[model samples]
Target: MQNFGLCLVIKQELKPIPLQNVVVEANIVDMIAEVTISQIYKNIEKDTIEALYKFPIYEAAAICEFEAEIGGQRKVKGIVKESKEAAKEYTEEVQKGHGAYLLESESKDIFQCSVGNITSGQTVVIKITYVTELNHDSESENIRFVLPTNIAPRYGSSEYSSSSNEGKILNPDVVSYSSKANYYLDLTVTCRMTSTIQNIESPSHKISTEMNIDENPKISKITLTEQITYLEKIFILVVKSKDLDQPRAFVEYNPETQTNCIISYNKKTFIYTALTSQEILTIQQVARVKSTNISTNTWINTLEAFRHDLQLPGKIEDIDTKEELECQLVLFFVSCKQQNGKDYSVQSIKTARFAIACHINLYSKIRPQDINNKNVYPDLYNAITGKIKILTKSGFGESRGADAFTESEIQLIVNHPAMQTDSPKGLLRRIFWHNAFEFALRGGEHYDLKIQHFVKRKDGGIDVIFYQSKCNQIRLSNSNPKSEIISISPNENIIKDYELYFTKRPPQCDDAFYLQSCNQAEVEFTGYWYKSAHVGRNSLNKFMNEIALVTGINCDDRKFSNHSGRKTFVQYSKSRGISDNDVMSVSRHKNPHSLSYYERPKTVLQQNTLTQINDIIYKKRVVTNEAKNQSTSFTAALEFYKGSISENCKFKALAYLNYHIAYYIIENNISPLPLSEKPRVPFQEIKDSQNIQLDEDCIKKFLQGNTFNNCNITFNMNQ
Candidate 1:
């Protein structure tokens, strides 16, 4: 087997730069601003290349329009649709070698734009328009407008990027920070104020201001003095006006929707009101829509129904009393239904309640603090806690975590015909299963494992080291305290499987540990089991399920996913009386409470415990001679092996002996071998029958003067 010690060497390459220029134009009126950002991309490479740009937007901003001009001729406008549908369309266009543009929201503040199939020397311009409210100082008459330019690296996995359409939207090329783009940013802002403008300045950059006071004293324009600036920092401009302390109200009529919206601002408090020809309603009431797809939009629909019943707007300012809020929540929880028009399950209801609590907490943070009390939503906060007791009593919360595999199920899986086969796929399955169960690896963690992570130890065991995982992404210090190292004892069967698999692995394959298998005919002819392609993520995730199906196990009643291996390891270790800290060392769990979630007992173990308790209570406890003998014999064997085996071959000899002893007991349907004063060959039958090879001198030395029950048996050495 090839030895890959610790680190992997990655070749450094020059990253590509496709973004050329960015221009921003903004028009501000009082507290609201409408901005347009234009990004230009050019393909300077000889062949066609896709350009992907990730940028930041204000969290509260609402994107209004997106348009693109490909090669400065063809104009394409973006349409709002479901994410999956839009991704499908973009993929189809890219597959046809045609120009396509896609703008998607990665998070509340992060956005990604892709220009696909940009031919050589082609220039594409993308424009995005959005409207946002200016940040106003509570104590001063100044309003601040901010335009985000740089998107900082985020830590967790993106919820949007983890969907089914991830492959189509997420490009690894866009994630590189080494690329330096030859680009310039130009920004122009035109501000219109209701009161007289006192001053306009930028604290972040040098800016030039122009006032058309002669034509209209309320209008002012601001621009960057340098004209050429890099997109490295946020652009902020503060506008101070006189006599801005008075309350103000503005109404805008939308002819398209035939509705009038009134915005009232007074002392940092804003109230939105909607007016129609028939009656006046709150903004939430007017925006409410009866959604037909209840499954995906249950949270929103439930909130809308609650507000409609009480004639309350979505804003926290519209809510008056604690009693009213509690009543509204009670109504929502009782009336909410699933997609099939049935009441939600206990878990689903709990999830919905969590979503509502998150909304309340968010509003409390953003709402202005009162002079009398610092807590903004005391009533609402109290309501959330008060309802929990009632909800729990109604059986609204229950946890149904992933199920662990039983001992019999594990035996069936490892001894299945597919696992024992000599084909390439079979070998891959064996390695995958063993690694997952032994190391307690999470599902997605297997996707990034490389050949370099495995290191051979001096004790003849293998140590699998993990440098990074989902729980530990950022390493703050030089010490690798968080890295998990799992040691595999030197077992004959396991070592042989690994050696054969490595020998048959294709040389063209990269450093990825897992590879997809080639056809059986190709493997037979070329002696290569796997091709150059790495295994697909979906295949790795469903590997355990495939094994269950082949073993004729029903998966409908219980979940047997890739996570089952991890759960099984935890449960099995606990059954063997392993300490929590010892298990945590192998599992690499930082929290003891998190480890408890995987410690569910199997039905058989639960029944055995109950029976033991009953026997003790009834004074019918009977300790069998076979049980005592089995325990004593195993303990004595362990001590004997520890004292007799040589330092160089201790691990291998002990593992081989233990495996054969278990096999002997199971084959003969008898009790464990007992230690005796006379010599005997406990594994003589296995030694003569099995075709496995081992060191002859080491075996002879170990059995030369060993005593076992006075039954002497001949030993055969096979090469």
Candidate 2:
């Protein structure tokens, strides 16, 4: 059964702000990230999602003032706010050929120079972008608002970008745009800025909306990260058998809570608590936004520089985007726990790196002239370009249950022709292949096979001890990297070790059935018909694409696709808000290290997560209060808590309309975003600007009378 739901990003956007002296400051309040809550939760259950938010807190304190440069240029001189006082110095893990960058909605995943400069009085239009790890869709399809809403909040367009107050632009190609409003904060006001603004938008299929301004700090640019939790949902912990001293095995949960901590089959009891201290350390270190390791940056930087070159007056629009791009693979560990309280780990595969590789693969064979002339991009072209190679051992262990992978699988990836080749595709492919072994671990039954350390005899099959990053370097003082812990290799030893624990089941005969899904990419890859890799993305992706087309499933178009699998598992864990140690036990990743990646700006989805956490705290309390009763298990308290949230927790918005649309875009796709509104938002001057009657036709089509307040505004979309 596909008990887990797909987490595809239906929409997204990205607004790049070049670090220029004059335009150093950025804001998010009046930007696209700002919107009314109703549009955000229009169709989804409010309790099921959480968000990872990152917004820059300008070094306001450091800004003494702005100064003019030698050429009469102006720039701001200031230090950013000091790093979080609570943040400890964390040494970045050494990883080659792996990093992160935002994929643009209109622009492909390829990062390129987007915005430039002008004078302070010129108005710049911005866009928003989001990177989603949810359900799959076509590669880089632009979702323009069927009707342009470039105006401010007050006056109405055919629709707001699904939320928020925006204006209408009958012609999209027009550059120097103007708005109706004059002031903005909670509202978009008209002003002018100098330069081409980087626009970022949400990827959700938006419904027309109108924004109402309220009192508060407005948002502009935002940085997001997904918070993964609650991986222990399918089962609970118990002992192996009834014997006082016997080998323990992980089992599934039974509703009843027994008096003894031991399992019905075995009497062995675990010594650790549900959540380990190692797990409580929420974040390891806050990293620089979109920073990349050297090896991985080669392609990324090259792509960045190349994109910059493309914006020239004579710049060709049809340049081979895939050839000029760079990509890498990275892996992070995850945690997992079985019914018997035994901890295990496994590897998850990543497909994001592959996506990057696919793009780069497209570029290798493209000659400058061919790129200039050809409209069709092929896959096999990557086998030709001559480029250097770099490899990254980005072993991430943020989740506990995702640690038991062997190197053989990694070797398979590392040795691919593309990986070993000097071409861009080769370098990209090699990184892709090498990173595969890290996230190869699957959940459920596959995780059961990773139980290497028997309770009776402590044995670590392959050791993976993590050292926390302190002061920017991994403090390996107490950890050993040489230990042989469980790995993802299909070598005889791993297969045997796995077979010793979990039995192989017959393949599911269902049409959509798949097996051993860790990153949860178990769907088909190829389209309806088999196709050759005339424009190959290496044998691996070509083969996968074929399957995807046939199965209507998709493989990740990004590198570190394996790691994404483990990340998905962690997201599942966060959904349940399972105890840290439980997360570690199931993921097999150590606790302290596991907590680093998930700590981010909390979103609406986390409301439910905290609700679960509150349930945990309550259960802990009940365990203490009812100790005298001796009739109920500690779990009874938890059951009571789960019941309360299930029955009583009301689905609501955090900040009504302004942020309600956030959840939709982050999980969907990306669009453009603006920093500050110049010339004000359209609706702020609704009474004076356009005739409200102009929008009558489209207004009826959008709302269809879903739930209209007295305002009852109308629109036709065409101004």
Candidate 3:
């Protein structure tokens, strides 16, 4: 009666605060947490009045349960329904003068609860329950559990607030003003961990803890030191445990839903580990069979690539379901490409599958039973067998490794006009070529070569120490040294070439082995031959094309490339009868089979075999002297143009003429022009013709079958 009289006395001056008290209870098992909050409200007004309150909660928490108790006797259970339908029902009930409770989300991290048709002096209780996974602190091994208790006042226009209808709810005119009402908060947290709990602390408020260390699964209870505290800030609880890195798994079964949810925490990431020991062993067995023996980094990178290809989220938890995992795997297998923008090779695809399978086994909730079930992931299984296996059988997207350079081709490249070592460009070209060949360097390996990597031996030889390579990813030099030491003999000309190039290296250049070539005249004057800028990868990769252009070796085939040097080294070693072990040591190949792929018959043997096969098949058809002597007109034309034009120009002119004549015969469906009908424009007339310009435009016209006017030349068979 005293409280009612006091409320009535205050009602004339100001509205009573509806929120009376809040009690929070939380239970944590391993990394998963379940929290329940109860908020009490009282209506002190005379007539029926609505009570509304806004609250904050963890953004990641899933609200699983809600209930309301009105007038301390009637109970109402909340059901998850569409927001609009729920709102409509609540509004209809309120309009009928009946009590209605409505709880809705205001934002991701905020919620609103409204109790309508509350009689004077009536009490209402609201309960909300949610579950979330605790976050792992990146700075330490502690697990963090956060419960937001306060919603700070927003300063800007409420219309722009993230919550829907926030402007009407938070309007200053509609909200009744009152002094800061005295409210009390009570919180208790119970933690159960697989490992022993080392410590428990709270940063937001003072907390007292009760620990039980001797339990098999250690238990701890935490409570606020002050029994009644204001809801002014967020509450935070941090738990540190012994053996935190050890893998742990927990399973929760819902009897009504007839479903199970598993949570596994291992190595700072969450995964589902509901399998028995035997099932885990079975997964390991399958992993061994499908594994590509790649490094851990390579496996991780392959999984990342698969995720990127499928446009999936990076977090494993988001894609841990069976359907999502299966769909992503199928898409990745079908559409993923290599770094070169080409379809992945059969072996590479298999490796990717292996990596993805391992990732699923390690991080996803898709159980082994689901994976092994034929009907569950049919498309994924079919993709693995039909697409990948068919590709393997057909040898689709397989690389026919680069062709090796022959002895004569190598000689041509070394002696070509552009290979002169007098200029900076020429010297760089020479050094790059020799280093790639002599060291069996793969493409892009020379880009990181440094002067410090080339160590001079006491015997006047040089040792090229590779700190890292494709096989040796970790650059640890001590304890488990994987660096390859390649020795260059003192007698090799490449040693002298290296010495000369380094002698002219500029002082401003860094430790990079390859330097940009500068102007020849500038190099001579400044005595600094190369620029300080490091040679780009484009220049290094184009060296083979440059060599091919100048020497005309395999220029038409275009089969030789930067990787040709490594292939050449292997083939050259085999031709010299070098043992497999010796060759593998220099090539840094772990498998002899890899080296055998580069082995082919010697050039002489290949030619001889082809000739022998042809002789046996066709019986060596003999040629008549008339057929052999069919070059009379060609010789006469060459002699006719002699001393009139340069030899190079004369050859080019005759070649162009022959090509056009052949094209004309094909286009007209006529026989070749007879020797007697060949046009013989005198050299003096060709030289004196003003219309016959030997420029690029004239050459283009000639190639296009344009005729010369003053020279009296026409490709007309009838004339």
Candidate 4:
């Protein structure tokens, strides 16, 4: 079999100069950094040029400011208007011959900037400012800041590209390594540390640093060296603090809002508590990072902000009593078995702010200072819930949908060698999960598929239970936000696959799957086995990419992911004319809007409407035009003239003659033009005698079964 391949070709040869210079400044304070980027552009072309450029940034960063400077003067500050209003104002200003610039978020991490009416020899400077918290390297306790230099190409279905702001990122030619743009960058950083600073350095570029020893020794200035010219890879700066690794807690109050907040954390869990509106608001968020080192890393996993707010108890003295905390439920209870096989280890869940917040009511009870003097929870159960009520409201959280896979692609992935296993434990695990996914199992629900959740009946039927995120912990009712149970017959392929898998499954790890041994010797190995549900999602994502590569599917991580399977199930079911309710029953999607997102318009070839219409038109045309051989000689005569002709010259000559011949046939209802009025290409001709002679020669050659070269044929000039 041929190797799967994907090729991206730069189709446009006209590379216009888009940028002249870029200037960047960053100021770091504690965990937050504010960055400003300024880009200069000059239009040398005689006509006015409207420049549209897509830029990248840290996904977590919030854009706070924008401005445009025309001809080194006339500054126009950007307003955070609605997208439509911004576009309208930009168009109106540009129509009035005034320079305008509009900046809009393309995605969480990408932004599009449009500069209008840069007249000849005019320079325009556009600046953008944003703020983001610095990411911490857990092992080294160093804070890292990165500025993205290149936009990674995104891939998806045609409908996905058209419906979303993905066109710029999906363009093949706008790559990180493209040298067509001659823009260079000048970057400077000013660092201010709360604790004593150990050092500040850049891994991506050489830097010159200046220390303010006479002033605050903790403050420093750094700039990239002159040799670094291209903004291709990320510009990464790391700052190490001497004692920031210790467990810490702090409280702050905002007088304007009359809000008091306490933040406390060690390493695993972060607690945030806010007192506002006469209510105590507490959130327990977790952080998951794949890399333990400060070295190479791409993704920082963050969970959604889980918020819980309740009215304060009637008496301040009642706060410490357990009776007042009756309504609260510990939402998460994650347990991982250690390799030693005897102990059960508590696992910390990674939510958005796990390392940040502390509820005042709970903090006073646990007295973290008395326990460990750090924010790290002594027990997972304690960290999960502390007199906190489970928030009752249910609604859709913001999440981008993944593209669905084609049927063929799905089959290829399911049939891939990696999925086919004979080992007892591995086989059973793979088969069960693969079948589950085929049956429309969602990523979130996968965690609920434990051994207890599976029930095999005596009559060869099996029922598997799973839970949706909203109703998983605290249930409002049985049917309102229901837990789903999917049943499969014994004779079904899914059952057989599961049976085969379980028979050969390994004995050591009874969990659905076990983590493969780490390749590095020095790395601390977690002996705990993984359930299909608890595996790092990134691992599954990596597997999805591998499947794409092996299946010859044209997809990237952004387009095809673990969620694609669920989407595929929904789309395929809907395409088969299944009602939304029926499909939702199995899929457990509570909202119709969630399911409707997959109902994108079908591709052109899949529409069939246009093809059917064309087919009917062609058939009718065939019936009316009974004389099928009407243009036989004209085609042959054109072929004769085209022999040994230069392609460009032939195209020009043949196009002129063919159009005139077509016109004559349509208007005069003739088979061929008469010899007296021979239709010929421009700068070429055949006189009456020449046409007759050419016909006689063609007939003779046909009779003799002889081929004639272009030299054997003769043409009369326009004279």
Best by TM-score: 3
TM for candidate 1 is 0.38
lDDT of 3 at 654: 62
The candidate with the higher TM-score, 3 or 4, is: 3
TM-score ranking of the models = 3, 1, 4, 2
Model 1 poorest ten-residue lDDT run: 1-10
Give TM per candidate. 0.38, 0.18, 0.40, 0.32
Question: Judged by lDDT, which candidate is best?
Answer: 3
Over 4 Å off, model 2: 1-480, 487-560, 574-578, 585-719
State the lDDT of candidate 1 residue by residue for 220-304, as single tens digits: 9998887553534446799998756677877989999999999997754453466684564444333322221223256756677
Predicted candidate 2, C-alpha RMSD: 44.8
Off by over 4 Å in 3: 1-317, 335-348, 351-382, 392-397, 473-479, 521-525, 601-719
Tell me model 4's lDDT, rounded to 2 decimals: 0.53
Candidates 2 and 4 compared: the better one by TM-score is 4
lDDT of 4 by residue, 4-23 (tens): 01111125222344456667
Better of 1 and 4 by lDDT: 1
lDDT of 1 at 92: 97
How displaced is residue 81 in candidate 4, in Å? 1.5
